[model samples]
Every structure is written in C-alpha cells, then in structure tokens.
Target: MSPHAPVLLNEVLEALAPQAGDVIIDATFGAGGYTRAILKTGATVIALDRDPTVQPHADAVANDYPQTFRLIRTPFSGLAEAFAQSGEAKLDGVVFDIGVSSMQLDQAERGFSFMRDGPLDMRMSDEGVTAADIVNAWDHGPMAHIFKLYGDERQSGRVATAILRRRVERPFERTLDLAEVVEKALGGRRGAPIHPATRVFQALRIAVNDELGELRAGLEAAEATLAPGGRLAVVTFHSLEDRIVKAFLTERTGNAPGGSRHAPTAVETRKPSFTLTFKGAREAGEAETVGNPRARSAKLRAAVRTDAAPWGRIAA
Candidate 1:
C-alpha cells in the first residue's frame, strides 16, 4: 500500500509550534505521519482514530517512541472523556486532519473513492452501519437531503430518486454499481474533470460516518480539553467543514455580533479564547499540492485557548 501523505505538513507544524515534553493530541491519526513528526519534537502524543485499521500504524510507532506515544481507538469526538480517563491534565496542542484519509481512499476495500471499485462500505469505524445501508435502505427524502447538503450536488433529487428506484430491484452492494447508477442519472459527463458520482459518494460517506456531527463534537471536546495557551490546528477539505471551524473560532473569540454594548466594540475586551494564528485560511503550497493532489482542497485553521469559558453562554 502506498504511504499516506499528511497535507500541509509545514503549516501544521508551524501552527502547532510543538515543544519538548508537551502533551499533544493527534486527533485523526491516519498513517501516523503527523504523530511521528510531533513525536520527533520530543512531545508526548495521544493519537486517536475511529478506524481500527490505524491501530497497527499506532502500534508500530509505539515500538519506536515507547511511552512517548499512545493510540486511542475511538472517535476524536470523544476526546475529552478519553483524555480525562487517560489522566491527562491538559493538552499542549491538538491537530485535526479532517475529511477522508488518503489511506482509506487508497484501500479499495474501504470504498471511499469511485476511482477504485470495491464494496460500498464507507463506515470509518468498521463496526458501524455501512454506506451500503444508507444508499440501499434510506428513504428518498433523507437520501436526497444527503446528496444535496453533504455532496452539494444540484441534481440530488434526481440522483436520489434513481438510487431508490434501482435499489428496489436489487440492493446496491458494490462501489462501481452505485457509481454506475449515479453516472447514468447524470447522463455521463463527457470530459468533466471529476467523476459524476463523486458528490454522491462523498454524501454517502459523510452520512454513514456522521462526519459533520463528529467534527462539531470533536471541536467542542478539543476546546474543553485544551489548556490555556494551548493551540488547536484543524485542516479541513470541504467548505461545509471549514464553515463550522470558522464559525467555532469566530464565536469562541467573540468576533461575532454582540461583542460590546458600547463604544461600537472596536476591539474585543475579554481576551479572545483563541487569537487567530493566521490571517485567513491557509492552503497547501504549490509543492505540497503537486506532490499530493488531495491537498488541493485542504484549508488549515489554528487558534489558542483562552482562560475564559468561551462556550458558557452558547451551551446554555
């Protein structure tokens, strides 16, 4: 299997600013690329991944890093509880490389891509309900919503109707079969840069894994777990995920509406929970993008935690 390349490595390291003896969290430890790099800084790493496949990679790293590195086979969404149980007082930094990992897409059996034909099983955690279940069994309304919202496909209704109609005759099982149905519905784009079924497959994977919800929960957990002055760096591959990260940062820093009651609120008073480390979303450099095409859509956002409770009012 080809090795998984961590996107925007330089930027991640820069934003995270790793220091020796610091306890860090590698929230989405795919192939341990980021985890390994962080460990090289002499920082302790608590790696987490929902997929059990990553455990082997983590195990391998543990041999090299010894007690400096540990892996948790659970979603990053449950990070707070996991850290607490691990007896970690606080985190120095947390890194989240969101969206489907290259490892999963490259492995045909994982079925994250239309490029490779495999069983339509896109569940990040192998134990959960697979993409096949969502595609083959969901009602037309929810299926349509998935395509439209998650996939951002304009032809969601038609595509969902096609899948529903076709699956009635025979339940969808393979990646190619579902891709064929979507392609047929899309009428076979002659020279489109991307496959017609790309969006549909993305929608199915997102739905099956509850990726958006996981992202929200993970962000909340990260915020709660971060020590004052600790940094959190998130790299997102899609607009939907980026928006959530952007909103969360904005809200936590009190950069949103209702900042002040007087003086027009020129600057935030209550030291922002996370001072924006970068001016705006940082994209992968040309070299990185050329090396890994998947880095094309990647956006990295970083912030630091403040002493105040940023989510107190919002949560209530």
Candidate 2:
C-alpha cells in the first residue's frame, strides 16, 4: 500500500472512472497517491499543490509516468489557470482530497497536529500568515469566531480568552505550548477521546491557509474547467468541508430552493451547470476505515458537468 494512503481511494476512482486519452487533475496532489492511481488508468494527469514539500513525491510520479503526469506548484484554487497553461481546453476529470494530508501531520515542523511538538507555523504553502501569527496577534473576537466557525469548537470564546491571557506573558511560538494552554483552558482533556486542542488546531490551520475560501474557489474553477460530461470527485474529511461541497453540488445541480409560498423567491435563475453523480456523499467502507483511521471521517461527493456553460458565463 502507498504510504500516502489516500482516503476514499476506491470511491474516488469509481467516481472519476478515468480512461485512455482522458485528461484529469488531481487538485490536491499530496504524496501523489491519487495521481499515480489515475495515471495507471492511462489518463493524463495534471496535479496541483501549493506546498513546496510535495515536489519530491511529485518527482517520483513524474519519473515513472513521465509522459502522462505533470505537477504544478499552485493551490487547487488555481486549477483553471494551470489547465489553461497546459494548452488543454478543458478537463475530463478532477479529484480533490481535501484538507491536510497525513504527510503534513507527520512532519512536526508543519505544525498541523497538536500531537507533535513543533513551531506554531501551519501554512500549507511557504508563504502567508501562520497559526502563530493568528494566535499571537489577532484579537479575541476574531480568533474566537474562527475557532467556532472553522473548527466548530463550542468553547471557542473561552479558548480564545485563555490564549489572550497566556500570550501576554509570551507569544505562542510552539505547537505544544499553545496546545498546553488550550488543554488547561478546556480543563485538561476531561477524559476526552481526543486532545483538547484538536479543534483549535484545526481551526488555526484552516484560517492560516484560507482553506474554506480556497475550497470554494477550487470548486468554481473545476466547474469552469471541466468539459461537458466531465466528472468531479471531492473527498472531504470534516463537516465544514463536506457542507461546502454538498451545498455547491446541490446548487449547481439545480436543486436550489424554489422558495415556499409565504416567502416567494427566485430559485437559481441560471442553467444547471452540473449534475450530481450520486444522490449523496459516499463514505469509506469499514475495511478501509479500520486500516486507515483518517478514512473514517471521509466523505466523497461527485458530479458530472453538463453541456451548459458555467454560471456567470454566457453560453456560446
């Protein structure tokens, strides 16, 4: 098995069903797990990831599938531009394995996991604001907002308050240092199955990388870049990411609200740009989940583009 162990691998492949001569994009090519699998099906893959650290793995894939694979160092949100530069008019398939990869979490320096003691940096790419920057500088209100909105932490305000109180003595420069403060604030784990700092760390990572914004833009870019009948498969590991994917597919497939009689409103007036591949998101099988704990939270949502032009674009 590949070290990357991409979550929902079989399900994503089923959704994509790449074929010879097909052009696909692995929009979040962490460790090249999906890329390699797609390349084996004879599809030409253009992989995108902003993290510079993935280059070595990208190189390995390129070495084996030299003619069919290319890795671009850019966020998935830039998939449209990457495809445009590839001289390909449109994509046949696009697969996204969303959120931080195991490779990142295992690297202590990445600071994505509170379990690992490292610098507070959590930028997916080399550039941009880091988790330390947010915790050390941002006001309590904004910090708490992100904790609640991004991480869904019920004690966001309390945690933010604790961070503010602690940062005054010295800034949070390490992951464990911040984790300890959050743990203390949450009353020392209280026999929780997971660490008390888990949600806060998740929220911080998402905010530092602008993950939610990137995901939205990436989906739009996929919509715009996929050819009619092209397939899209997105695997999300958390409710926040899953909700965005679910809502995007729902609206794009023309399942938007038609408004009740009391509150008459114009349902999405544009043509449906894509159709859902299945009725609902798919989850990993029990076997897969047992082998890969990360797969337990994975949800795969897929769709196929329609002949209609993308929303906001005039159909030619």
Candidate 3:
C-alpha cells in the first residue's frame, strides 16, 4: 500500500462513529478518501470541495454509492448554507481536512509547490485572486505583513524588499521564479531541511485563500448545522489552523480558561454549543507517520454538538 494514505483515518472513524443511514458531511472532500470511508460505514455523505479538479473523485464516489453520496461544488466554509439549501435541518457528522490537499500539491500547475516550476496560480477554486497576483502586484509593506503574520517567516520584511526590487524588473509569473527570488532574498537554504521559500509560499496561499478566516466560518457553520450528538472532526495541518480549532472547540465546549484575579469576568455567557469529545487533540500514530509523512503534522480535535442553540454569526 502507498504511504500517501489519509491522515488520522481510523481516529476520524472513531470520532464520527458514522452509522447506517446517518447523513455526514465531508466538509473538505479533497480526494474523497474520508468520504469513501464514511460510505463504507453505510452513512450517506455530502462531500464538498471548491476545486473542480476533484470532480472525477466525486464522480467515482457518486457512481459507487449512487443514492448514498452527494457532491457540492463549494468551499467548506459554506457547509451550513449548503445543508440548508439541501432542505436538511441537521447533520450527523462533519469532518474538515484543513490546508492544501495532496491532489493540489502533486500538480505543479497549481503553484503550491516550491520544488517545481509552474504558473504562479494558487487559487483552489480557480475563481479568485491568485498568488501571482499578490506577489507581483502587492506593495512591500503588505507583502511583508502577510509573510510575517500568515507564513510566520522571520525575515518577512527582507523578503518583501527583495520581491519589490525584483518585480520592478519583471513581475513574477512562475512559481519557481518567485521561489528563486525569495531564496535569494533569504540568502539560500544552505543545509536547511526545507526550502527557504516554504514559509513565504504558505503565507501567500493562506492570504490568497483567506484560509484562517474560512476556518472560523466553517467552524460556526458546523455548529449551526449539526444536530445534538452530531460529531465534528477537524484535522489541521499547521499550528495556525490548529490554534483556531482548539480555541473554537474550547469555547463552544464550555472549557475556556476562566479569568484570573486581575481580569474580571462577565456575568452573561452563552450556553455551550458542544461537548468536548476528549480532553485534547489527537495526533497521528507512529505507524501512520511512517506510512504517510504528511500525517506527521496532522492534529485532530473533535466535539459532539450539543442541543443548545448555535452561536450567532460573526465576521468571516
């Protein structure tokens, strides 16, 4: 078997506990791996993905499961709206696999890889502003801010300075071009395990996609759509996303840390909308880590939806 297996597969199965006839949502149905597993448990799956390139996988699942599977061509952030559009009031389970998919990264044309040369496009839906647009057109200050905040790159200002200087000569139109410029700006990787352009690419991808914002919306959407006892499983590939998931689950599950003596607390608080499924996040097993290197960074945090009214909408 290939080591490119799905991350935290068995753990997700354990968390969701999908049963026959249950309606589950594979909120980020990248390769449809999780959806397929859900289908095997006799659960009906509503799989969503913004990337049209994933249509073939969707077609295959729909073909195999026919009446038991549905594919929605939309971002996972729209989970609640899609379910409402389907005339369904509640969901039994919802799983979100956050960050770029293997399908996207494996292809160079998507411009998600720093290792390969490709067009500088990184729009998952192919319908929005691209990474090329940002790198080539964005100002130095904004670009630096994005790299620092979103990518966690320490030398963000320096990189931005380099990008601005280079783009003045010729705007970056290729993935490798921008990567090389960044590498040069950072003074080369030397012996670093990863490429110097990794963080910059990640920041650009996140900014272009508004990933962190979308994650917040998706979490609330899941809260609104799930029925009592419904399961919500989120698998994040990086610290930024994992932090958001952890906080959301914590507050919704009524486990937020209490205020200290110096910080007084408010009198009113909304009832918890979920119950913690476990104490904390779950990591990939050693076997999984070896089988799928991508699983090494994967962290799963799940909760069971409570009967309490869902949280009100917030800015995405």
TM-score against truth, every candidate = 0.94, 0.95, 0.95
Of candidate 1, the 10-residue stretch with the lowest lDDT total is 307-316
**Pick by lDDT: 2 or 3, better one:** 2
lDDT, candidates in the order shown:
0.87, 0.90, 0.88
Q: What is the lDDT of residue 296 in candidate 1?
A: 96
User: Which runs of model 1 end up more than 4 angstroms from their true locations?
Assistant: 258-271, 312-316
**Cα lDDT for residue 307, model 2?**
93
Compose the digit string of candidate 2's lDDT tens values, residues 1-316.
4557988888899999999899999999988889988999999999999999999998999999999899888997788999998887658999998999888999999989898899999999999898999999999999999999988899999999999999999999999999999999999977899899999999999999988888888998998889999999999999988888888887788897767667654445568899889999899898998989999999999999999878732111
TM-score attained by model 1: 0.94
RMSD of 1: 2.6
lDDT of 3 by residue, 53-98 (tens): 8888788778999988889988867888888876665589999999
In terms of lDDT, which candidate is strongest? 2
lDDT of 2 at 102: 86
Worst 10-residue stretch by lDDT in candidate 2?
307-316
Alpha-carbon lDDT of model 1: 0.87
Name the better of 1 and 3 by TM-score: 3
- The pairs that clash in candidate 1 are none
